[model samples]
Target: MAERLADWKQSLDVALFATRMNFRSHLVHPGEVVLANLGALVQAVSGAAVFMLALSTTGVVHGWTLAQWAVLTGFTTVARALWNTVFFGTLDIPDMVRSGELDHYLVRPANPLMLILFSKVDTDVWVEIVIGLGMMGVALQASGAEVGAAVLLFIPVALVGSALVFAAMHLAVTSLSFWLRYDAMLSMLVWRFDSFAQLPMSFYPKWVVAVFSTVVPFAFVGYYPCLYILGKTDSPFVWAFPLAGPLLLIPAVLLWRRGIARYSSTGS
Candidate 1:
C-alpha cells in the first residue's frame, strides 16, 4: 500500500508539472489566450441562447423545466470543459502516431500516456467553466434547491467522476489509432456523442437512453449526478454514480496498454 501510495503521488506531481508548463506556454501569448477564450465564450453563449429560445415557446422539455435543463447543461458543460482542458490533446493521438511523435513519449521515463495526455492544455476551458458555473447558479436559484452540505460535497465528486468518464472514453477511442494507423473517424464519432449530455435523457427514445446510459454510460457523467443533486432521483445507486468514471478506466487502460504494445514507429 505504501509503494502504491508513493507511485500515485509521483504521478500526481508529474501531471501537475506538465499542467504548469502548458499554462506557462499559454501565458507567453496572453492575447492569443484571451481571443481564443472569447471565441469559446461566444459559442457557449450561443448554445445557451438557443436553449432559452426553445424554452420560451414550450416552457419545458420532456418534463424538465427550463431551470432543470439549465442545470443539466451546466453540469455537462463543466464536465466537458474539464475533459477538454486535460485530454483534448489526446484527439491528436492518431496524427502523432502517424508522424512518429509518439515515439518520443514512449522513450520518456515518466508514464508515456500521462506525458502525452497533459502535454497540451487548452486555456480557453476557463470560459466554459465560468459560463457553466453561472448557469448552475441560475438553475439553483430558479429550482429553489437547497444547497446542503451533502450536495456541496457531492458536487466535486460528481465533477471529478464526469471528467474521468469523458477522459476514459477519449482514451479508449484514441488508443485505436495504434491499430488503425491513420483514421480518426472513431474518435471523432465518440467526441461528437458528447452532445447527448447537454439535454435531458428523457427527451430521447428508450433505445437512445440505453445506448448512452448503458453502452457508453455518458449519462452518468452529468445527467444522473444533476438529478441526484436536484433531489429528482431516489435510487440508492445514485450515490455510486461517481465511481462509474474511474471504474470505466480499467477497461480503457487495458485497451491502451494493448495498443501501446502493438505500436510500431512510422520512422519519421
Candidate 2:
C-alpha cells in the first residue's frame, strides 16, 4: 500500500511539473497567448449574449424562469470550461495516434495516459474560467437560490465530476483510433452531443432523457448536478453523480489499456 501511494504521488508530481513546463513554454510567446485569450473572450461573451437574448424573447424555457435557466447555463459553461482547460490534451489523442506521436509516451516511467493527458495546459482557457464564474454569480443572484452547507460542499465536487465525465467520454472515443485508424468523426460526434447537456434534462422527451442519463451519462455531468444545487431534486440517486466521474473513468481506462496493448507504431 505504501509503495502504491508513493507511485501515485510521483505520478501526480510529474503531471504537475509537465503542466508547469507547458505554461512556461507558452509564456515565451506572450503575444500569441494574449491574442488567443482575446479570441476566447469573444466566444465567451457571444455565448452569454445568446442566452440573454433567448431569455429576453421567451422570458421562460420549459418550466424554468430566466434566472433558473441562467443557473443551468452557467453551470454548463463552468463545467465545460474546466474540462477544456484541464483535459484538452485528450482531444489530441487521435492525432497523436495517427501520427505515431504516442510512441514517445509509451516508454515513459509514469503512466502514459497521465503523461499524455496532463502534459499540456491551455492557458487561454483562463478567460473562460473568469467569464463562467461571473455568469454563475449573476445567475445565483438572479435565481435567489438557497445555499446550504451541502450545496456549498457539492459545488467543487460537481465541477470535478463533470470535468471527469467529459474526460472519460473523450478518452473512450479517442481510444477507438487504435483499431479504427481514425476517430475524428466519432470524437466530433460525441462533442456535438454534449451541446444538448447545456439545458435542463426536464426539457427533453422521456426517451432522450433516458438515453443521455444511461447510455451517454452526460446528464450527470451538468444537468442533474445543477438540479441538486437548485434544490429541485432530493433523490438519493442524485448524490451518486460525483462518484460517476471515477466510475465512468473505469471503462475509459480499460479501453485505453486495450488500445495500448494493440498498438503498433507507424515506424516513423
Would you estimate the TM-scores of all the predictions? Answer: 0.92, 0.94
lDDT of candidate 1?
A: 0.86
Q: Tell me the spans in candidate 2 whose CA falls farther than 4 Å from its real position.
A: none
Candidate 2 shows a clash count of: 0
> Which candidate number would show the highest TM-score if scored against the true structure?
2
- Count the clashes in each prediction: 0, 0
> Which clashing pairs does model 1 show?
none
Checking candidate 2 for backbone clashes, the offending pairs are: none
Runs in model 1 lying further than 4 Å from the true structure? 1-15
Candidate 2 lDDT, tens digit per residue, 164-254? 8888888899899898866978898998988788888889999989998888988988888988888888888777888888899899989
